[model samples]
Target: MRHTKLGRTDIDVSQICLGTMTWGSQNTQDEAFAQMDYALDHGVNFFDTAELYPTTPLSAETYTLTESIIGNWIATGGKRDKIVLATKIAGSGRPYIREGQPITAKAVHQAVDASLARLKTDYIDLFQIHWPNRGHYHFRQAWNYDPTKQDRSTAVSDMAEKLEALGECVKAGKIRAIGLSNETTWGTQKFLSLAEERGLPRVATVQNEYNLLYRTHDLDMAELSYHEDVGLLAYSPLAGGILSGKYLDGRKPAGSRGTINGDIGGRLAPQQQAPTQAYVDLAHAHGIDPSALAIAFCLTRPFMAAAIIGATTMEQLKVNIGAADIVLSDEILKEIARIHRDYPMPI
Candidate 1:
């Protein structure tokens, strides 16, 4: 696996981050452990998860269960020092967690301590906010998202308070770095500005949806990544396994994300068929695995820090990780661009 600096931090993480959202839900603990073992053996050192993980179904019962699985593995295998772990604290949305309250200093402290205990670790390598309290255009919500209703002063104040809380975490040695998820270009800029002005924690990375079908980040967010030095941790690079071509013609194989979740997190929409087939066909025409081709496309961008890959089965894990080694040729890349124009904004 290739390595890169995590923003300006001294830590070096693998270009392919092992995502654990499927763990303890779509996958069993043993399956998750097998995937992690294989990934680590292959030099994949970065693992990303969130407090609201296993969202194939997130519930009060399964809260922090994914972290517990990882913690169990680290405790049993003694691999804590070998991995660079990253996890998120869910923002206000679900009532079970903190009564669905907005992110505040007390909430941050409560979350960090609970996560530390469940993770069986004293310090978390990277801690992140799962989403903005003010909300942004992600998770297929961009089509009808309205930002005009938000209060400007309130948004800045909320961010400032969150930054102060994160700063306290850093000072207490609870977390090494801080990051954002499901955020907008403007929101990221505000965080960057506040961090610089207040001398708080600087944003290290942005975890958002970035796949062939979802290219919203390609326009403005890419500029922020290049100039501000905050790289993207691209999630759903395979579009929830839609790009594998197995779900084509409405075929939902047993246990597939589509068969289980019904929507594949809004990625397996009927409108996305043509776009997905174009890339899958392109991959086969070039004698590459369709899944690898899809993932490889996400890594091609210069601003990509790491592409997070999740799999329910070990075979899928190997195929996704293999993309890190495959570099698309100019001819293939040009063909991909041509396909993109035919089906832009597929979601």
Candidate 2:
């Protein structure tokens, strides 16, 4: 697997990050352990998880269970030193976690300690804020997202406090690097500027949804990533498996994400159908697995640090990790671009 320096940090991570959001929910502990073992053995060293995981059907009962599973795996296999582990603390919106409170200095310290205990690790390679408290256009919120209602001064103040807290975590050896997820260009710029001015923890990466169907990151965020040296940890490179054509013609395979979660995060809308079919057809025409083609397309981007791939089955995991090695030829790339022009933002 190809590797890259995480943002401007000296830490190196695999270009393909193993995503573990289904553990302990859709998958059993043994299944998660086997997936982790196979991923690490196959050259995938980076793994991404969140405190609010097993999100296929998120619930209070399954809260933090995924982390516990990973902790168990690390403790049993003793492979903690061999992996670059990354996880996130959820922001406001979930009542079960911290009573739906916004991220704060005290919350940062508390979360770091709690995650450390649950992960059974001394330090997190990359600890990220799952989303902004002020909220941004992610997870199908772009259509009606209105930023004018936000209080800028308050938001900046909150960011300053969070940075100070994260800086303390760095000092305490709880976390090595900090990142952002589901954030906007303006928010990222604010974090970067604050880190420089106050000697706070620098924003090393931005984890956002980036796939052929979702190209919102290709505009201002892409430029920011290039100039600021903040790499993108692209999530949903397969568009919740839409790019795989499994959901075409309204067919839901058994145990698929769509079958479990009815709409797959509002991704089963009518607009995405033609574009999805086009990409899938293009992949087949070139004798490539549609899933691999979608993921490989992500790695080709100039600012992509890693493409986060998740799987419910071992077979799916193998296909996703194998995508790291499938280099798309120029002919295939141009064909992809042509398809993109035909349907830029279907999702």
lDDT of each residue in 171-244, candidate 2, tens digit only: 98899999999999999999999999999989999999999999998999999999999999999999998888
RMSD of each predicted structure: 0.9, 0.7
How would you encode candidate 1's per-residue C-alpha lDDT over 1-347 as one tens digit per residue?
A: 78998888987999999999878888899998899899999989999987887777778888788999998998999999999999999999799999999999889988999888888998998899999999888998888899997888799999999899999999999999999999999999999999999999999999999888888889999999999989999999988889899999989998888877888878878899998889989999999999999889888999999999999988899999999999999999999899889888998
Residue 168 alpha-carbon offset, candidate 2, angstroms: 0.3
Candidate 1 local lDDT, residue 301: 91
List pairs with backbone clashes in candidate 1: none
Q: What is the TM-score of each candidate against the true structure?
A: 0.98, 0.99
Model 1 bad stretches (over 4 Å): none
